[model samples]
Target: MKKTITFLTVLLVSINMYAQENLDLLTYAHTQDINFFNSIKNGTQVKEYITVSKNSVKIGDTLILGTPTSEEMSIRTYSGSYGTKARGGVAQSRSTSKKTYEFIQMGRPAGFGSIMAAMNGDAASMADNSLKNTTVIVNEIKTYHRGSKNKPLYVVMVLGELNGKAFGINKYLSVMDTELAVESGEILLKNRKMTRDEAIAKLKEAKELMGIDMMSKEDFEALKKELAPIITYKNQE
Candidate 1:
């Protein structure tokens, strides 16, 4: 019995190790991506169903895709002397005139949200992402590494094709200074097992009703239970 248990434990550990190895470990620079990164890591600790990674994904798995945000960068130029003026009479850091340009999110993602985001961004949101109601299923999973560092960044990209139902969101978070092209934030990889978008919307409505005492706690609870699955990213931080 002891030998059997030991072998089982070792097998389980090995399986987990293999899964982690096949997964992509990525880093995010934006607030939205950072939050998503943190949430995915934290969420896994609290729930079970699946973990977001390449190894766990297979062909035909439905996925929510991210849209393009800011693929361009603007320039800011400044000029001056060691003072306020080009020939500073007063003491100040020699600065020049100023010219600045930035990419801002208009709270929307450019088209081709699937390929672009998968290649560049770190996360995707279930709610308020680029393609609201449109669904994508995995067509391919590609893995690669970049950079010259000892630990190169490994990316496992999911190439998806539209399942085609509906698209668009009631609301979406925007990246500052970017106007369509790439939205590098608010990528939601965390999920609540919902079969329909209306389910989440209904839950939000119910919560609102409960808050205003239009619905009793018991009634809201009942509704929530019937809705099954969990959350809606209505006011996520």
Candidate 2:
């Protein structure tokens, strides 16, 4: 009985290790070939969904996408000496410039009334008083297939309201940005589990890239401890 138990434990561990190696290879492949990742097609038909808090929106309501400007300054200095022994003074001047090209508009304006009517009055609302506070909803949705199984890749346009004012929030939903993408219909795909040795190797490479040397020893230990479970392999089956 003891011998059988030990053998089972070793078998499980080996299986877990193999799974981790597969996951690492897949992740590496996706990073190397983005078009290959995006080319994957799934059979799922994408649908639009919306969630809102506050008063219902209608047609003719204005939606604003505000983009604040950025400014930078460059300085130059000159030094000169005249009519004095070992006397010199430095003068410096700076010119301020603004960057106007970084602004991005995700989508064109759509009337709130027309949008609500188009959906056959499918809507939601939440009540709040602060003029600056607003609830955002995915008003327009598009999808494409990505990955080997052709999983759906959802891109959505977000709309919001502050007080009685309507506005546009974002054009694209991306995983790198925030968790809100999930609410906006972004799909989360499963990755294969990794084994202990493979996890450690991958983590070491990540630590080097993250400049762990820049962190205090305590901070480094804290971060590692927090991430240890995430990097460690577990049996999914």
Instruction: Tell me the alpha-carbon RMSD of every candidate.
Output: 16.9, 23.2
lDDT value for candidate 2?
Answer: 0.34
**What Cα-based lDDT does every candidate model obtain?**
0.37, 0.34
**What value of lDDT does candidate 1 attain over all alpha carbons?**
0.37
Expressed as tens digits, the lDDT of each residue in 1-237 for candidate 1 is 687557556644632332322223332221134343332321111111122211133445554434433233335444446455475453334333322112212223322342245345534332323344334554333222232222222223232335442335313222221111112322223242333455778988999999999999999999988876435333322
Strongest candidate by TM-score: 1
| Tens digit per residue, CA lDDT, model 2, 1-237 | 687557556644532332221111122223234564455332211232222111112222233322223233446654454457444565555665543212222222223332343346542221112212123443332222333434433322334344534433433211211123222222211222333455578657657756856556566577678668855435211
Model 2, poorest ten-residue lDDT window?
18-27
Tell me the spans in candidate 1 whose CA falls farther than 4 Å from its real position. 1-49, 52-56, 66-135, 142-155, 160-208, 223-237
Candidate with best lDDT: 1
**Deviation from truth (RMSD, Å), model 1:** 16.9
